[model samples]
Target: MKRTSLIIVSVLVLLSIALTACQPASTKVRVATDATFPPFETVDEATKELTGFDVELMNALAAKAGIEIEWVNIGFDPMLAGLSQCQYDVAIAAITITEDRKKDMLFSEPYINAGQIISVQKSNTEITGPESLAGKKVGAQLGTTGAIEAQKIEGVELKTYDSYDLAFLDLANGQIDAVIADYPTALGFIGQNSEKLTTVGEVFTDESYGIAVCNKNADLLKKINDGLAAIKADGTVQKLEMKWLAGQ
Candidate 1:
C-alpha cells in the first residue's frame, strides 16, 4: 500500500510540472528606433527622454498588445542592422517601406505618409523646383529616401550627410545650395531656423513610413497590423497626424 501511494504521489508531481511547463511565457517586446528625427523620433536635449510621434505610437501599440517594450535608441544605420541581428523585435523609426528594404525585413502597414521636400536658404530664391536645382549642390542625409530622390535628379551635385541636422547645417552655411528631406523633417528644420531657411513650394516624391520587424516574426507582425487597423478605425492615427504633421 505504501509503495502504491509513492507511485501516485510521483505521478501527481510529474503532472504538476508538466502543467507548469505548458503555460505560456510572458511576452516582452523590444523596439529599436533612431531618435534623431524630430516629430517622428527625437531625444530631448535636457531630459534625454525619447519623445515624438513614433515613440508615442509604439507605446500605445504596446499597451494595446499587452506587451512591455524595451526601447532602444541608436543611429539610423545601426537600427536596421540591429533589426537584422534580432537585437530588437521591431523598428519604429520613420523608415520608408521600400522594395529594397522589404528584401530583408518585414514591414507593417505604413503608420504615416511622407513626401520629399526641398529646403533652401531663405536668401536664395532662384532655385524653386527640381529643374532649377540642376548644376546646384544638394545635401541629403545618408541612407534616406531624400538621398535616393536627389540622386535621381540630373545635373544636381548630391552630398550625403550622416544626419539631417548636419545636412541642414551645411545648407545654412551656404556649403550646399539646398537640402532635400522628408516634409515633416524639413518643416521641423525650417521651424528651428526660420530666419535662415525655407521650404520650396513644390514637394517631390511621396512615400509611406512603416515599422520594420524581422521577416520571420509573422505573429508579431500580425499583432502590429491588427493594432494598426484598430488605431486607424478609431481615427487615432489621423488625430496624431493632425497634431504633429498637419499644422506645420
Candidate 2:
C-alpha cells in the first residue's frame, strides 16, 4: 500500500512539471514611461510607485500575453529615443501617435483617442481658443505634440517644460498665458485643482495614444496588439476607462 501511494504521488508531481513546461515561458518586457502625466501614468504620492491608466493597462496586457515587465520611469524625450535605441522594449506613456513617430518606431493599436486642448487660469477671460494663443506665452511639455503645435501658433512664445507639473506651476504663478495639452490629461490635472485652472477651447486636434515599439521588433508588437485586442473584447479596456475617465 505504501509503495503504491509513493508511485501515485510521483506520477502527479511529474505530470505537474510536464504541464508547467508545456506552458509558454514568461517573456520579460521592459517598458519606459514618463510618470508625470496623470491619469495616464504617474508616480503615486504615498507609495512612490508608478500607477495610473497606462501603467495598469500595460500591466494587464503583459499578464495576458505571458510577459513579465520592468517599468522604467524617465523623461519623455529620452523615453522615445531609448525605445528607438533599443534601451527598452516598449514605450507606454500617453505617447501621441503621429506620422513623425511612425517614421522612427511602430505604434501599437491606439489604445485611446484624445485631442489637444487649452488650459488657462480659471479667472482668465482673454483666451477663448487656439487662435487666442497667438501673441501670448504658452506652455507644453517638451517633445510632445502639444509643444510642436504651440510652436506653429503665430507669434506665440512657447515655454517648454520637462514635466507638466512644472508647467502647471508656472501657469499658477502667471508665468505663461496658457497651456496646451491633451484633453483627458488636462482634465485629470485640473480635477482636484479646479479653483486654479480650467480647460478652454474645443479639442484642437485629433490625436491617439499608443504603445511604442521599436520598428524592428515586429514580433513584440504583435504580442501587444493581440493582448490589447483580447482586453478590449473582454471589456477590460472599458472598465479601465470608466475608472480613470469617469467625469472626463
Candidate 3:
C-alpha cells in the first residue's frame, strides 16, 4: 500500500510539471520614456494621460504587431541606461539616432524627421540667426541635441532646462533671449503662444528620431521595424506627420 501511494504521488508531480511547461509566455512589452517633451511625448494636464505623436505611433505599432505594452515614465537622461539594464523593453521620446548611442543600444529605423531650430520673442528684432544669439542668454532641453547646439554658440549663456516648456516659459518671461529645440516641439510651444514667440533661424541641424530597443531583445527590434515599415508603406506615417506637424 505504501509503494502504491508513492507511485501515485510521482505521477501527480509529473503531470504538474507538464502542465506548467505547456503554459504560454507573456506577450506584454514594457515601454519607457521621458514624457515631458511635446508633440512627441507629453501629458495632458486635464486628463493626465500620455498623448502625442510618439505615443500615438507606438500604439499603432503595437496594434499592428498584435502585442500589448505598458508605458512607463522615466527621465530623459536615464532612458538609454534603463533599456540596457532591462528596466524597459522599449524606449521612445524623441530619441535622436547618434553613433554614440548606437554603440550601447539598438535603435529602430528613423521614424520621425526632426531637426533643431531657434525660437525667440517676436519683438526681438536684433537677432536674426544663430550668430545673433552669441553672448546672449539661450535655453535648451537638457541632454538634447538642442542643448549641444546651444553649447556650441560662442560666448552664449546656455541654460539647460529639463524640458522645452520650461525653457519656453523663461523666454516668454524675459529670462532668456532665445530657445534652441527641435522644430516640431518648438512649433508646439509657438502655437500656444503664437503672438509671443516665433521661429527665427532656419533648421540648424538635421536629426532623425528613432525608437530604442535593447540589444538583448533583437526579436523585438525586428518586430518594431516590421511594424514601422508597414505603417510607412500604408501612408499612416504621412497622416501622422500632417496631424502633428502641419501647423509647424
Candidate 4:
C-alpha cells in the first residue's frame, strides 16, 4: 500500500515538471505584414524568399528583443483583423499611424515618416495636384490612408486595388488617371517604370509609419520599442533606410 502511494506521488511530480518544461520560456512574438509592398516587404520573384526593409528590420528587432518571431503574411486588410484576434504580437508593415487605427490597436513610436503622393503616366500632363484631380479617376490600395484621402477629394472617382502593383497597373494601362500612395512606394514604383510614370507636383499629407501591437499586449510593446531604440542607436535603422529608401 505504501509503495502504491509513493508511485502515485512520484508520477504527479513528473507530470508537473513536464508541464512546466513545456511552457514557453519567453513570449512568442508573431508579426503580421503584407508582403506585397516593395522596398518595405516583398517576395523575390526568382528566389521566392521574402526580402525588403520591413523584413530586415523585423528580423533584427526579434534578435535584439531576444524573442522568436513567426511572420504571418496576409493581405493588408486582413492584418488588422488578425491583430484584433490576438494572432500576432506586433505588426510592422509600413502601416501608417492614423487616429482611426489607434482606437483599436496600440501603436509604437514612429519608425518612418512618410508622405502621400500622386503618380501618373509620364505622358499625361493634365493632372498636377490634388485640386487638379477633380473629375479624374484616382487609384489607391484598398484600406490604405491613401485610399481614404483620395475618396475625400470632390469630383474625383476613387478606385481601390488589392495591392500597389495592381493600382500601378491600372494607371499604366490608362484605366486610372493617377495612383495615390506613400512617397517611398511611389518612388520605388516610378523608378521601376520611369518611362511610364511620374510623380505629380509634390507629396500631399505628412504621415508616419509605426509598429503596431495589440492593445492588451503592453509587455510586447515595450520590448518592441526597446528593440527599435537599440537598433536606431546602433545605426541598423539608418543602414536599412539608406540601403532600401535612400538608395532608390
Best by lDDT: 2
Query: Distance (Å) between predicted and true CA of 124, model 3?
Result: 0.8
Each prediction's TM-score against the native? Answer: 0.89, 0.90, 0.88, 0.90
lDDT by residue (tens digit), candidate 1, 1-248: 99999999999999999999999876688899888787788888899899888888877776676667888988888888878777789998888889988988999988887889899998998999888889999999888899999999999899998788888998999999999988888887787788999998777787989989988798999888887887778777888778766755
**TM-score, model 2 to reference:** 0.90
Weakest 10 consecutive residues of candidate 4 by summed lDDT:
80-89
Over 55-172, each residue of candidate 3 has an lDDT whose tens digit, in order, gives 8899888878766899998878777688877788999998888887888789899998789898999999988888898789999988888998888889889998877789999999
TM-score, cand. 1: 0.89
Cα lDDT of all candidates, in order?
0.86, 0.91, 0.87, 0.89
- What lDDT score goes with residue 109 in model 4? 87
Please list the residue runs of candidate 3 whose C-alpha ends up more than 4 Å from where it truly belongs after superposition. Answer: 1-26
Candidate 4 per-residue lDDT over residues 55-168, each given as its tens digit: 999889878988788888889988987786677778878899999898889998898999999999999999999999999999999889899999889999999988898999
Better of 1 and 2 by lDDT: 2
Worst 10 residues of 3 by lDDT: 77-86
Q: CA lDDT of 238 in candidate 1?
A: 81
